[model samples]
Target chain A: MDNPNLEDLLIACRQGSDDAFRKLFEQYHMRVMSTAYRMCGNIQEAEDVTQDVFLKAFKEIKKFREAASLFTWLYRITINLCIDKERKRQRRQKYHENVDVDSERITIEEANSNENTRTLDQQMWQDEIQSILQKALSRIKPKFRTVLVLKDIEGLSYEEAAQAVGCSQGTISSRLNRGRKELKTLLVKMGMGEEYFQER
Target chain B: MKHGFTQKNLSAYLDAELSPDKVQKIELHLQSCESCLRELQEIRSGKAVATCFENPDWQDTEALWQNIQRLNISTPEKGDVKNLEMKRTNLWQRLIHPRPAFAIAVLLILFGINLFSNLKQKKFQYQRVQLDQELSYGFDYGLYLDALVAGSPAIEFERRYESQQASYEQARSQTTFRLASFTHMPKTFQLREVRLLKNACCRSVQFSCLENSREVIIFQQPQGHPVTFGNYPLERIELNGQMYHRIKTGKWTVLSLQLKESQFMAIGEMNESDIAAIIFAITTI
Candidate 1:
């Protein structure tokens, strides 16, 4: 019974108790790393982000309260950090985007081309039915994408998902519904809708 | 049940949260709609698969719990050790070589400030007169940064060209519901002032087309390189009736705007975040 849940670990970390912080980190490290990995597209960036999140959590653990779960607080920090990292990366890519005058790399032609399709199929779609699912996943806006990842992909309940993404339950439900619809449409577009999955 | 139910209704039905009538309707809708049926199946499959991943040996993550030992780990600033080493060497030398070295360091710091202010004045002064006329106002950096850092005066604004303007006391306040229409300048920029210059006189907004934008200029002074886009003079556009325009004038780019309502000049020399608060204070007069 004493095996600390998220709340316990947060309380422990707050008291400057290393054991409590360690327990919380241990329980959530993989989840946090995996979450970051999925949120961003790279494993290395996720690992770095994991370390940064822990370091920040350690420093700011004093601010942790019972209002939200420890994991939710961790997620807010992680998402913010990852977004910031993406912005910095864009700063580095300024030279590249600046050179291209015609398009921002996503031209209608490029979007429909076989090369991009193959790339999308190969990269986003890992297995057979998974590809169509991925196209659907890709169609969701960034705001909704995080919600789906947390809820369906990560299997967090509605409340946990809301706290993690910093939104209300109603918002989470709406986003999840909209995301589900978009994902379904994406699957249909990929020609792997009901007919394809009907066999499975 | 033509459009039987949304994915939301399906899930609610599955979760048993839907009313009986809603469930009956959804069930009828699902019976006929092939697409919704497929999506429901796919979600069930994904959910089952997602469950199999049951936190994957999070129990054995005990090894990672060792990182918790680092909770007490004194996080050091990246520069601390190097600075310490430099200080150690300086301390040893202080014991050996004393007076002139200390005097020289002080002299260097004073000289550094003088050199910095001189360069700042010279660089800004060179552009001041042309900028002043173009901006339709006198140039004063100190007065401007302070007004932005505190808050802009609660002035009544009456702009002939402004379609809309939203002002906030602090930059962070601007990011809430007010700017949901468009992205506000990030609060990290630490804004010093927010002023909406008239299209008749405010400096050119290089990359924005938002007519009559709530311009949030950060108060960060410039460091390192100045923005240089070759010889292209900035292009200014007065937004149409109610669109917003975002413009940045950092040390590298000096944007001076002359408008009918007010003389609006954006002097860029600092990082964007340092002046975010001031930028948020901007409102239509």
Candidate 2:
């Protein structure tokens, strides 16, 4: 949504209009949900991040500066939550690895459960390729993955993505290059073959 | 174009984030250098591959909207109410869980203040007794009257009398009074008892009558008792060549008469007409 209408909605929301809030939720929930899914790699976590972002946005709407677009603010919140969730998961995993003797079995069981969820036919080329890409994407560092997801996957312009990620356009450019190279190397390692990256 | 452009520029060129001039320079370089062209193709393909992470289906949107609604509803508006709530909560928290040193200091300060006030009140009680004796016309009656009224000694006396009514009753029964002095009281006012003031020299007789449950007190001070009724706006009325002083203090109007040995002061909530009648009746005795 355009800033003027969004600014109007924000003003109305600040003036305590439930209708304006509902309109804002309707307008941004999809994009916020999509960006969260791209960043977190799961529908459930993405929904949680989406809800958190909008709830945060609603609570802090009075603090929202007109200089920044509403989506950029929402994107920043969603990104932070995703990063926090990822860090907490990593910490828990590290702790479990240290204390839990059956950590290896637990990891295998988690993998099996994840595999079980993707019961989509492997014969479908798009689903199979996309599933492999999702796994490779999750394997990359979050800093690079975020830049790549915002720029390449979510299709935000470099300037918009920079604003969303709280970085300069030049940094977005550099990170996109590093992220693309890492993803390409990961895909090749996963037997997608070099030819998969050669075509435009 | 000098080194076939860097990978950062190549990525920017693919993203169309670079300036048009930079884009043209990179495109021309890509055309001249087959390796640069192949690398651009690789970056483009990789970018496309990354786009394969499709957005999952949105779920629980109603629940999320409800949550957002709840958040908005629960948020206090930007006003004094929100600040007041935060301040109230902070005050409540501090009050309940005060720091040990702070709580101790507060308790000590409060105890000191209470102790100091109690000591001052005890001093005032003693001073009040001195001021009451000085209320009789002797030296600087205005200053002593102002001090008495300002300190409100009457309220203190009332408080003491209420607390020690039985003690006052015992003192009243033990006290002796002249039977002829009893004639100074009016017929409507029944003489309850004669009680001694704290100063053993001063005595007061209490009288009660069923005139709207009113009671009168007559202070009968001994002869030449250094006490005078001179401070009040007294009207000198010579009844049958003997002088009487009529005065009003707050709700009670007093009729005072000086005899050869003692001063008699009668005080009651009696009206002007009733006061004249009582004065006339008391003086005739």
Best-fitting candidate, scored by DockQ: 2
Using all chains and alpha carbons, the TM-scores for the candidates as numbered come to 0.42, 0.49
The sequence of per-residue lDDT tens digits that candidate 2 reaches over residues B1-285 is 665355557789887777888888877776778877776666777786775566655657898788656644554642222332354366767566757668888999999998997666432110001123423433332332322323343443344445435333443455343222232334455333333233232233222221332444444454455344445676887765778776666655566777766666565556655555555544543
Model 2 CA lDDT for position B127? 9
Q: Give me the runs in candidate 2 sitting further than 4 Å from their true place.
A: A1-4, A95-127, A193-200, B1-5, B31-38, B71-285
Question: Model 1, B193: alpha-carbon shift in Å?
Answer: 27
Model 2: per-residue lDDT, tens digit, A1-200? 45557767888877768898889889888888887887777888787677677766766787776734777777788888889888988887752322322443344344345554435543344455666677677777889999888888777888888888999888888788778877886676555644456544
- List, for all models, the DockQ compared with the true complex: 0.07, 0.26
RMSD for each model, in Å, please? 23.1, 20.4
List model 1 lDDT by residue over B1-285, tens digit each: 756345655544544556688778888888888998876776554344332222222234353344433332533532132333344365767665768778888999999998997666432111111122332233334333322322322221112112333222222222221111212333333223333332323221111112222332322222321233233345544333322223333323334333334333344333434333323233221
> Candidate 1 on A1-200: residue-level lDDT in tens?
22446566666667777677666676668778767765664556776677677777777777667634667777777777776776677687652422322331233224445565657676433343343243345345667767767876776777788788887766776676656556555444454424333322
| Chain B TM-score by candidate, in order shown | 0.26, 0.31
Q: Native-vs-model 2 lDDT?
A: 0.62
